[model samples]
Target: MKTPPDRSGITFEVGAQLEARDRHKNWYTATIEKIDYDKERVLIHYRQWSRRHNEWFQWSSPYLRPLERVSLRRQGLNAPMFVSGSKVMACWTDCRFYPAKILRVNKDDSYTVRFFDGVVRTVKSTKLKPVDEVRT
Candidate 1:
């Protein structure tokens, strides 16, 4: 793993590993997508993969989700920031984002995002960034 450059507060482009919480609040792997960053926050684009349908879908109506914590797979590598709105390429199967909107910005630096499909989700700031600024 390599260190991610320090681009906090600057809208940068990047790919993200998105996870969604089930009813139990346990995180489950979801789709990865592109993002756009603005200051401390970001706008995320959602990409959804349906196993049952065996296909991929692009969504932009859904708001961005912030990342809480990013960890590197190896030691001493700068972990990736889960910025909002930044675009991410698929590293594996079943990674994508869902179109959503920001309903509210929480005091804990988290956001309440609502999808066009009527799903309201809460995401942290760690998952967003500008679409053009990502390295890959």
Candidate 2:
């Protein structure tokens, strides 16, 4: 199979779905509502669903994952594959998944990861999920 291209050349436009890392290392799937290339930032709108309340939220960030990296439109309907150094969402104790980069593969098959907020942790493979599923 062919490999995906680097995301360095990819550009964002209005209505593009992107995964963005927040200051707390949490990642959320959002749609680009506005782009400000001069400031290297974009405004994103996302939905928040809760038992008590459900609403649409807007946020802006500089760190974003490319559509190619976060999209689930692949050859099959199976889970997306990930490797060391891959960007993923790791489940936290608060029952939330945060944005993190897989640092290393442990002997037991677990992974050491560094969150975008500068926190590091070791987590089981099951506790990890793809950024693509953040929306669905």
Model 1 quality (TM-score): 0.27
Residue 20 local lDDT, model 2:
65
Candidate 2 residue runs with Cα over 4 Å from true position: 1-81, 133-136
Model 1 agreement with the true structure over 1-136: per-residue lDDT tens digits: 2332343322234455443443455444444333322223222333353444221222221222224332222232443343444332211113355445566655555556655566666665454332354357
The regions of model 1 sitting more than 4 angstroms off are 1-95, 129-136
Q: Each candidate's TM vs. the true structure? A: 0.27, 0.38
RMSD of 2: 15.4
Task: Give the total clashing residue pairs for model 2.
Answer: 0
Q: Total clashing residue pairs per candidate?
A: 48, 0
Q: Which residue pairs overlap in candidate 2's backbone?
A: none
